[model samples]
Target chain A: MALTQEHIQQRLTEKFGDLVSNFETPYGMLSFEAPKDQNLKVLQFLYDEADLNFQFMTDLTAVNYPDKPGRELAVVYHLHNLRDNVRIRFTVYSDINSPDVFTASKLFSAANWMERETYDFFGVNFVGHENLKRILNVDEMDYFPLRKEYPLEERTRIDKDDQMFGRG
Target chain B: MTEHHQHHIKLPEGSIEKQTTTLNVGPTHPATHGVFQNIMELDGEQIVSTEQTVGYIHRAFEKLAERRPLYQITTLTDRLNYCSSPLNNMGWHLTCEKLLGVQTPKRVDYLRIIIMELSRISDHLICNSIMGVDTGAYTGFMYIMQYRELIYEIYEEICGSRLTTNIGRIGGFERNFTNTAFTKLEKFLKEYPAALRELENLFTRNRIFMERTIGTGPISAERALNYGFTGPNLRAAGVDYDVRVHSPYSSYEDFDFKVPVGKTGDSYDRFLVRNEEMWQSLSILNQAYKKVQEFKGAEAEVFHADVPEYYLPKKEDVYTKMESLIWHFKIVMGEVDMPKGEVYHSIEAGNGELGFYLVSDGGRTPFRLHFRRPSFIYYQAYPELVIGGMLSDAIVVMSSLNLIAGELDA
Candidate 1:
């Protein structure tokens, strides 16, 4: 039997019970948020459950939401089930100051470098990561470059009308 | 030197013996084919362990995509896995289409499949032939280079430029496929198979090639999945988890093709799997072309959809129609208001699942855009694959993985 969105929600809701919240099917993909601390527990449950096995870690990256004060960094995990051909988006948010979450590298080796990249960009420190040093940027680099504060350009050009573009 | 020093440090009588040699295979080594460092600890000729350092070619594509509008980001996608850039280009367009709910016509879909499969063939040809070159057989590369050139000529006919061809727009192609393009496609279809067969014969059954790659750098299906392997590398590990089959995109469902699988997950199996995939891609390309030819009259002329907001207006239309002139100005400036949505669209590129996770804040530019690059994910498993293997075999493993540094460090 193919896994349905309802079945996944039911199983997750039954296990996580009020822990996992914000269940949504944006663009027909099951998206939900788990508390930053209990991320591994939710992932392990999803992995161990025969019916809801999302073993393939398709992608792991971080998103920085400058507007949100408390929940500033969101680490998004795109997981896939090859047998059933189903994919789900799992997300967890942490404060920018204490952006520490348990690393999924123990369960998925794919998360090792991905988490490091997340750290490199959005500065989501994956707690318990074996080698969490800067992967992309140089070791001497101080600030995270992908943060919203860092503008791509200074925008000093006076040639074109800024109102013509969306920035106005 | 063995005597214990009391207060003062004594100089060693002889140089200290280092057991293992740390070898840097590349940030620029020819075997790597791109810029990325692999620090391998070796005991004589056998690898003890290896650590990889990427980002030498990091252009910060993801960072750049945040500020640019939809059409402007297409060029960035092209530079990712430039071997099959059309695949990434289409994937980005498809992601935007999904977010905006813009459906493309069947003719457009079929044409995209043809272009995509051609790029796939070219990419696989390069990878498989490079594997042969690494394993002491350079003749296969020589035989297949001309055929790859023929595929590029077809791209040139469609889009004007060859490599990094920003071929397709959001809804469909920039223009209709010309007669010259079809003739070039026919030429490629007629001639590529024989050359591909010859390249196969040069490497597949050769005893030396087989012995060199058969047992080197083998990974199990379980390990491959854990390491997030996909495309030919995962298939070579005896898993048939192709993105085309698993998640159909760009009317891939309309075409018929076989997903080739391999056992033992070694360099040789990877080579064979890629070769077979190229054949399947060719078959699919032929089927798509036949389907495209079946369209007649007005249906044949439909290159792009009726997306007045997105698609650029022609020069004549801009001159005559007032709305067309305004839309053209707006489109050029990238000022169209896009609906807010988060969409993850992936396509089966030459390598694996090239996923685009896009987040829109109801603005012209995307709030967040992440490319789930296969090269980046595959490179993570390199150390595990080549550990304890011969150094020469590691080169074969690298080529077989087909890790492009542009995509890897994106």
Candidate 2:
């Protein structure tokens, strides 16, 4: 039998107490928010515990909310348990000043590159990564591209007279 | 030298010398089906490390999908992995269908299974044959390529474009399986077994081919799982998991086939797994052909078929009926309200678990979409797989892993 959202909420609340926060959308999905410090604990439990072995980290992405004051960025992790075919989403919020979150690389090695991609696009720092460098775009890039505030249109105009020309 | 210096650092006495060499294998190389680059660090004939730099074929698909209407994204899905775009398109449509809470008819489901399995056969054929080509087995490559051509011909008969076929619609297929497609597929089905047998007999037991692939790039099942390996890569590691059997989307449940697993987790085992899977796909095609032949109908949905909100409203209906005209205008103007929710739908795409996770916030476009691509995961394990193998064998390892650069970069 598949565990419903209610069972997930009850089990999580009973296990972790106030460390977890449940956000219920109008849709049936229950977005579970755990404290940044407890992210790994929550993930490990989800993987090891009965009825919630979310062995697969389906996707990892970061969303930027520039308008939001306290929480300026959110890193979302979507996980799935192949056994029961159950899925759950976990998110952690951080502000721009020190936008840092625990890395799940130790739990799932696949998160290494994915977390780096998220960091490259959204600038959310995965604190424990050994080599936290940009994976997709070139280095020395000034800004994160995927943030809502960053316009997709090119913001910089090329200067015709800036570069040295080929000489005879 | 001092005792401390001897333990920490040392250098051999030699005259200062500089050596420079470079090798470019991409952008037009036959091995690279799409635009891809690999800059290799070399020490003479041996490669030190290879840096794969992609995105040359970057259509900016994710950004394009955000800007375009839901249906328009289907065209972009065609660009994700052009060799097997039908499966990618089906994955996108199935996600949308899940969001709409709509199900396709049983016949349409069978058609989807048949086409997708055919595409899988073609993809595996390319991977296996390309491995042979890279390993200098030209005859095997030609034999498999011949069969692949037959599959593409069948595809062209069904859809105008053979490579980038935007075949599946939001709720069902754009059209039924054409009679020509069915006949050609049936013919190919009968002949593919013999061709596959010939290739198998030639390569599977060949001493040279075995030495090139067997025990090369060996990865245990535990390591494969840790690295998030899927598709035949995971199967080669002795996992008995196939999304078709586990998830059973479309009419996969109705199909009678076996999920072939491997004993030794190596490139050779992966090759054997895909070889067995080809025969299994042939069985599926044969069964679907028999089932499709027995059916006698218009070959598509009837009442809900004319869904003006989702599908295109017919010209005749629009001219004759006011409601049809109004709904048509609404749909055309992008005023129809889609439900605000997220749907995660997956299918056993040719490679592996090709999942499309779409979050539609009651708008004309999805708020967020994610593709659970298989190559992306498998490529993450590339360094681990090829670290100890010879430089020449990297190509064979890559081919056995079936790393499609388009899908990986996308």
Q: What Cα-based lDDT does every candidate model obtain?
A: 0.90, 0.75
Model 2 residue B165 distance off true place after TM-score fit, in angstroms? 0.8
What's the lDDT for candidate 1? Answer: 0.90
Candidate 1: pairs in clash: none
Who wins the lDDT comparison? 1
Candidate 2 lDDT, tens digit per residue, A107-128?
A: 8887877887778777888989
Q: List ranges where model 1 is wrong by over 4 Å.
A: A155-164, B1-18, B319-321
Model 2 residue runs over 4 Å out of place are A1-8, A23-31, A65-69, A153-168, B1-33, B38-50, B298-306, B314-333
Please give, for residues B1-410, the per-residue lDDT of candidate 2 as tens digits.
65654455455667546453455657567766556666665556566677666556544556556545667788887766676888888888777777877767777777777888899899888888877887789889876788888888987877677888877666666555666877788789889899999989988999999999998788887777767777888898998778888777887888899989897778899999999998999899888777767666565333123354676566688899998899777665456656887666778777788877676767777666667777776677776776545677776787788877778767
| Docking verdict class for candidate 2 | acceptable
Computed on C-alpha atoms, the DockQ of candidate 2 is 0.23
DockQ of 1: 0.79
The deviation in Å at residue A45 for candidate 1 is 0.5
